[model samples]
Target chain A: MMNPTAAMLVIGDEILSGRTQDTNTHHLAGALTGHGIDLKEVRVVPDDTGAIIAAVQYLSDHYDHVCTSGGIGPTHDDITADAVAAAFGTPIDVRDDARALLMAHYEQAGVEMNEARLRMARIPDGAELIENPISAAPGFTLKNVHVMAGVPMIFQAMVASLLPTLSGGKPLLSRTLRLMQPEGVIAKPLAALAAEFPDLSFGSYPFYSNGTYGTNIVGRGTEASELDAAMARLAALFPMDGT
Target chain B: MMNPTAAMLVIGDEILSGRTQDTNTHHLAGALTGHGIDLKEVRVVPDDTGAIIAAVQYLSDHYDHVCTSGGIGPTHDDITADAVAAAFGTPIDVRDDARALLMAHYEQAGVEMNEARLRMARIPDGAELIENPISAAPGFTLKNVHVMAGVPMIFQAMVASLLPTLSGGKPLLSRTLRLMQPEGVIAKPLAALAAEFPDLSFGSYPFYSNGTYGTNIVGRGTEASELDAAMARLAALFPMDGT
Candidate 1:
């Protein structure tokens, strides 16, 4: 993981309509962590072109890389590709690279590429296709933005393929411990533990009840030993003995 | 829901590092959905004040409401409070209302409020504190922006408490089916399904061969009868033949 920074923009009104649960953002975040690239921001807007363009432009300019999920489908809501091009003030054309991929994909399945399906071929000028092994409609990389399918499986595959090629920092490590005691009871001691492990990032993710929801005190960092030391201190403060 | 829109800004570098698994974004999404308000966007940024302020300003202006998670801790990385003030272009100050909440909670827990602890009481001018039931330090609302604790439990509690007073749309309805078929095999039918149910949003998700992943063909709408009708039409497309 190289400390490279990135941002994710989720595009679709379905997400805002509460009709779609965004599986793409969570999956990307988890994958990016392994690469050691920091996901600095995530923004989801309706399939509105202006929102998508503004977010893509903002993130691309600010972060080392910017990844977008959703809105690149056959449907009308699939406006991500066009929006991304507009964001960079680039012209969108039916590039040979994307059309070949979409066509080959269609031919393999014994299908004719019609108007709706051709929408996948509209690539922004100077963009390269990110291989969609699972699905034939290839996602592409333009400037620093990587556009992938909205569906979680396709999205994850595209991200997995893209991550290894991207330079990143060291892999971050973590240690999680169950803390039954309330946060207020342990806040003082936990703060000391966090202070003691300045080299390691110790975040206290307190849960509510376990059978329903319980508090989990998690410690994390780039160093394993540092995480262990922090967790040890946290464990001592909130012991499992009384539970 | 009434199309009441909200966006989430998750402020943390720890998440991008893969050092921390962010639970706040998902938690807030679910909570807001339950309350019938759509969580349109979730942005995770580093502790950088400028980046935080930019995201806050963008989200607050575009959506009907904005909710931010993380970066509210006492540590130096906790720049959320400062960024919130910056987003509103207001001078930061430790208001009496916030100080009262933290003091009462600290007093009840028999802990002294030190300088670092008192920093939690700082709020932007003319903001209302969103009560934190789990921890004493309260979250606050500035205009339509609701700044809450990064911790999932506390963040959730803040939403649960604050949502009743806010306006929300009628909750959207959805129906999902696990399709064992490949995306390509069902592409035509799926496209037809989408066209048939023009008012309802339909999507085809793809999965892999490990007997693990399954594409959830989901349909969504405000009308239950319309959703049920779409589902029935979808079911008819699949032959009754089973493995």
Candidate 2:
């Protein structure tokens, strides 16, 4: 069976400005891979309403699932929630349930539920909240899009909470054969092996270290046996001992 | 004058499979920012021809420049050059200049210039080659799109060679003020500050550490004096000692 495809939309000016390096996409890609989902695409856009809305609409229309991180905070630049609502043509307001959660947490922490904090409670109509254990603010799922926090800790927690709820297909299995030979030497045979096992996908990644060239031939597929067979053929073609 | 806008397209399945963490985007972001070019958007797509063509077309239409990395290798999965040529409706073949460079390099290294190695010589028609000193394979610029290698070392080298050729605008100046207060506390005044300086952009990044919430308010503008005045107002509003 084909795995469900997903896309990640990372929204932040800080990432575009080179002030912050986004790790959420990498983390989400791994988690989704293990959960039998294919992360097909990732996009990073600045905190602009038009850009966010366009990306959301495009990604949502293309992929089975869409995960977004960043710009969900209480700051002025945190405009992701509203932009997402606009993308889906849904009305958003401070939902009572989300507000209650924020109110309870802030009250316990001796923090006032100010307007900016209340912005965190704004949820689109007919959306379910994704629990954020790290922060009191909740992420929401509207249609196929999962809107989450920009903070790494909170984004990770939301992903952890949300993944278990989605149905996953067979996990993608991968095996790698590292060869000291350059990719040019391995490419011809690797291409033949890839053609032989049409069910599997092969990737050759080259690296240079210590003044030598090496390539890592990775075979990926849902079936472990197919992956192993392809990897074995690749290993036979470029024997480590021979190199 | 408005800065020349650019978008990055990272093409590879390894990045999507979570086997490789992409650092090229971050490096390009910093480099473009330093060059006074605005990196407006970034997209990471797998090694698919349709996806690469679609992304390249969209980015080329939207931004002043488009930079792509990955899929320009000797392996079978390396289809970026062909896809990019298809995107612009231009014919691609092994150009004399690129082939000469690769041939010289392989001869010097005592390596045979086989078919797989010759694949690296493919260049789109009417495209200018971006010099790759690290590797003999050349990256090319077709119209607004600049296609480079995936490896970080070569990607950086290509970027260094390409940036000096592009025109840039005024360098974006940034100043930050860290406050020992929650973003909710700072949001209201920060919004007012943003409105007061219509030319400047304000971003508030929140952090939680040592059982306390603090925010880093970053003000960015092309004019250094304007940025400093706005930062001074923000600092006065959120006195550090008072918190």
Candidate 3:
């Protein structure tokens, strides 16, 4: 069976401005790969309403799932929720359950539920809230788009919460064979091997270290036996010493 | 004056499969920001010809400049050059200049000029080559799109070689005021400050460290004096200790 394809949308000016490095996409990619879903594309856009809405609309229409990170905070620049709501033409307001969660958490911490903090409770119409255990603010799933926090810890918690509920196909399996030769030395055989096993995808990553060049050939597919057989063929083509 | 808008397209399945963490985007973002070009969008797509062509077309049409990294190598999965040629309907072949450079470099290194290695010399029609000082393989610029290698060192070298040739606007200036208070505490004043200075862009980034929350208020604009004035107002509102 084919795995469900997904795309990632990272929203923040900090990432685009180079003030912050985005690790959330890498984290999400790894998580989705393990969950038997194919992550097809990732787009990082600034905190603009029109860009967010356009990206959300395109991704939601094209992919099975869309996971977005960033621009979900109490600050004035936090415009992701509103933009997402506009994308679907859904009205958003402070929901009772989301408000209650925030109120209880803030009250327990002896903090006031000001208007700024209350903005976190705004949920779009007909969207289910994705629980955020780290903070009281809840991420919501409006259609196929899953809007989560930009913070790594909170985003991770939300992803953990959401992935378990979604149905996924068989996990993609991979095997890697490291060769000390340059990519040019293995390119032809690798291409032949790829054609021989049309079910698997072959990727060659070149690395330079210790004043020597090497390539790591990774073969990926859903079938374990097929991947192993391909790896075996790869090993025969480029035999490593003492193996 | 408005800065030239640029978009980055990262091509590789290794990044999507979570086998590799892409650092080239961060490097390019910082470089572009320093060169006074605004990086408006970033997209990461796998090694698929259709996806690469689609992203290239979209970014080329929307932004003033497009920078692409990855998928240019001697291996089978390296199809970026051909795809980019196909995108603009230009014919691609191993040009004499590119092939001569490769031949000289490989001869010096005592490596044979095999067909796989010869693939590196394929340059599209009507393209200027971007020098790769680290590696012999040259990156080419076709129209508004600048295509470079995936390897970090080569990507950085190519970027350094390419940036000086492009015209840029005034550098974007920024000032940051760190407040120990949470973003909720300063959201109101920050919003007011943003409204007061319509020319500047205000960004509030929240951080959690040592069981305490703080927000970093960053004000950005091309005018240094205006940014400084806005920052002064911000500092007056959220006074930090010992300052």
- Best of the candidates, DockQ: 3
Native contacts retained by candidate 1? 0.28
Looking at candidate 3 chain A, the ten consecutive residues that score lowest on lDDT are A234-243
Better of 1 and 3 by lDDT: 3
DockQ of each: 0.27, 0.84, 0.88
- The candidate that wins on TM-score is 3
Task: Go through the candidates in order and give each one's C-alpha lDDT.
Answer: 0.74, 0.92, 0.92
What candidate 2 gets wrong by more than 4 Å, as runs, is A241-243, B241-243
Tell me the tens digit of each residue's lDDT in model 3 across B166-214: 9998777777888888888999998999999999999988889779888
lDDT of 3: 0.92
* TM-score to true structure, per model: 0.75, 0.98, 0.98
Question: Across residues A1-243, which tens digit of lDDT does each residue of candidate 3 receive?
Answer: 689999999999889988889999999999999999999999999999999999999999999999999988998899999999999999999999999999999989898899999899889999989999988799999999999999999999999999997888888888888888899999999999999999999999888978988888899999999999989988987666202
lDDT of 1 by residue, B112-165 (tens): 777666778888888888888877788888988889887767878987878887
TM-score rank order: 3, 2, 1
Single out the weakest 10-residue window by summed lDDT for candidate 3 chain B.
Answer: B234-243
lDDT of 2 by residue, A74-170 (tens): 8788999999999999999999999999999988888888898999999999999999987789999999999999999999999999999988988
